[model samples]
Target: MAEETVSCPVKIHMTTEIFQEETEKIELVLFGHYYEKGGSAYLKYEEMQEAGKIHTVVKVASGRALVMRSGAVSMRLDLREGSRRPGTYENGYGQFPIEAAADEIVHTRTGSLSGQLSLGYRLYMHGDSVGTYKMKIHYEEVQAAK
Candidate 1:
């Protein structure tokens, strides 16, 4: 038997916290599509910010995750526990070197269509430590109306 790709509309709730001089928290609710292929799961969503619209994609595997964003703000983040990944961030102004050192990455599935992902990492920009950050995402499939 071959594994088939499964795709569905999903609703996502995300919370992010940054620990710098002070802790800052941000939350967002987004609607998108969730799909599973091979042995990996992926989430695709769009976010509207003051800058403009940003498209985001997240891929979760065994012990690692990849996040990619494009539009007004663009960046690719590869997070793996106990390792530092180098990437770049670009916006209206310019592009800057960025890196992420992941301390923890936990992904849990409550059901076939519902799960949660949590990440704890340290962010560096321009070779300088920016801050420690925690991000949590919960996603569930949307049911079609009868």
Candidate 2:
């Protein structure tokens, strides 16, 4: 059977924690679009930072996820349980090699229009460990106004 594609406006709440010398936390609430196609779910959104605007796409499959960013900052992160994936990161200044070793990846679908994804991984830059990071994303489709 062929899977049907579905799309809708969504509100996303994201929290990221980095554990290095110290703990750092970042949170964001964003409005974006959520879609499912070809057996994968995708969330597309844009973020504004000091440098410029960055577009991000998060794709989640059965046991892995891919995060792609463009614009001001560009990177592609491939995350899977118990595996290390090589990728690259680039900004205005230069580009560098990066990798992610995912310790855990959990994706749960609460409903037809809502879901959550949690990832725990170690980040590396230039073959050096940067930190251990955990990212949680909760997204739900926006309801139409009455």
Candidate 3:
């Protein structure tokens, strides 16, 4: 696949404890880099929240390491469970409560990390009922254009 450059503004909030007991002070950082299937970048700072503790809201930077702005990003995931028989599409739209769980990862020049994060969303299914789904995403903060 061709290389595509995209800026991702990541905001991480932790409420768990790092390691086994000690609390942590989270430091959010923004970095600018080119992302590819097998590419990586570095963090502006080395200090981060404790290894296993959780943090409230950690502001990583003034805005984006590459730029600064206020915006919103949304990712949609569609899970297709195997049908009972076959040739039958079991897809409907309505009010579905979606429960998504995601984790944060920092792909630095040195290495990559995998953490545990919990996320939730409301999926609209049929009628007033909703579907709760799970989600897992790995990304990092990036710089925004000035």
Candidate 4:
């Protein structure tokens, strides 16, 4: 059987909580695509900011998830069950190493190609545990106009 695929309008709402003190939120409505193949699923989208455009790709596999972003701020994060991965955070000024340990990672599809993702992880910088974070992503396909 061929894998399923979907493409439609999407609204992305993301929040960042750092050190259990700082919080930031970004909500954007744009077009995105979702597809599943070879036992993995992918979500592709783009984010626009004042500095530049950020293209984000999210890949989901069994017991693992990866989020990659390129543009103004760049990062490649790996979230595997009970595993720690080293990543780099880059900006115009400089770059630094980030250690990410995921406590739990889940990507579930409620419909054929739409669902929510929830992740909980610990973040370390400079080899020191900085904080813990929880990220949730919920999206659905937008209906087309008549």
Candidate 5:
């Protein structure tokens, strides 16, 4: 059977907390697409700023999920539940090593990939615990492509 394609209009809000003291927040609105392929659900979105850009892809299969971010982040971060991945978050300055670890990831692993996603994780730079983060995403299906 062929996979059904749908448009996903999403709102993402992310908050980062550092050392139990500081917090940083980012909110973005972007459009992506959703499709089922090879028994997995895939979501792709491109995120771009004036100087930075990246593509975010979320893949879910068998009640497990991975969030991959590539391009302008200067590196590809493959994030899985309770797993730590080493990568880089880039800017105009240069690239720096970043370790992203997720402790709790909440999502609907089966069925249509819509609604909310909550990721609780921490960031480490130079082996020091720099911050913890929470990311929330809400995705809805659009009937038609724009």
Candidate 6:
């Protein structure tokens, strides 16, 4: 029998609508963890606002993957967005890259058909005066999904 395998990169873009109750500076973190090494990744949202560069990362498949017919994958991420850099108040947004290594986790009895993931970032008022700012992170696909 001939064997076949498929590989591709997954991209996720999310936008959030928040209401600021207090006028305080806030910092946020966004990340996602899956059943794969490096499957877990995160980015500093506050940095994005200051540098005007998008913080993103690439997720690699776990080398020690169990061959299964069907299963599920879970992911977790934080939606908080703000700036935390010192001596700056210029707000911006951008994307960055993420990477995952192989053989990071060693635990395999049976290749279950289910997968779970958890990811999120922290939000803290790192510097400056207090104020609230509503932010939304928009994603644009540069690479074609195959």
Predicted structure 2, TM vs. truth: 0.94
**lDDT for model 5:** 0.66
Question: Which is better, 2 or 4, measured by lDDT?
Answer: 2
- Give the Å error, residue 99, model 3: 30
Per-candidate TM-score against the hidden true structure: 0.94, 0.94, 0.21, 0.81, 0.70, 0.24
Clash counts per candidate, in order, are: 0, 0, 32, 0, 0, 20
Per-residue accuracy of model 1 over 24-117 as CA lDDT, tens digit each = 9999999999888878888899999999999999988988988999999999999999999998899999998899999878889888888998
Error of 3 at 88 (Å): 49
Off by over 4 Å in 5: 1-20, 61-65, 109-113
Worst 10-residue stretch by lDDT in candidate 2? 1-10
lDDT by residue for model 5 over 1-146, one digit each (tens)? 86555445443433333445756677777777766677666777888867577887877655356667767565545566667788676666787888878776666533365666666677787888878877666666655556
Local distance difference test values of all predictions, in order: 0.92, 0.92, 0.27, 0.77, 0.66, 0.26
Ranking by TM-score: 1, 2, 4, 5, 6, 3
> Between 2 and 3, whose lDDT is larger?
2
Q: Give the true-structure RMSD of model 4.
A: 2.7
- What is the C-alpha lDDT profile of model 2 across 1-146, one tens digit per residue? 65658888899999999999999999999988889888988989999999899999999898898999999999999998888999889999899999999987888989888899898899999889999999999999998789
Show where candidate 2 strays beyond 4 Å. 1-4
Badly placed stretches (over 4 Å) of model 4 are 1-9, 22-30
- Runs in model 1 deviating more than 4 A are 1-4
Clashing pairs in 1: none
The predicted structure with the larger lDDT, 3 or 4, is: 4
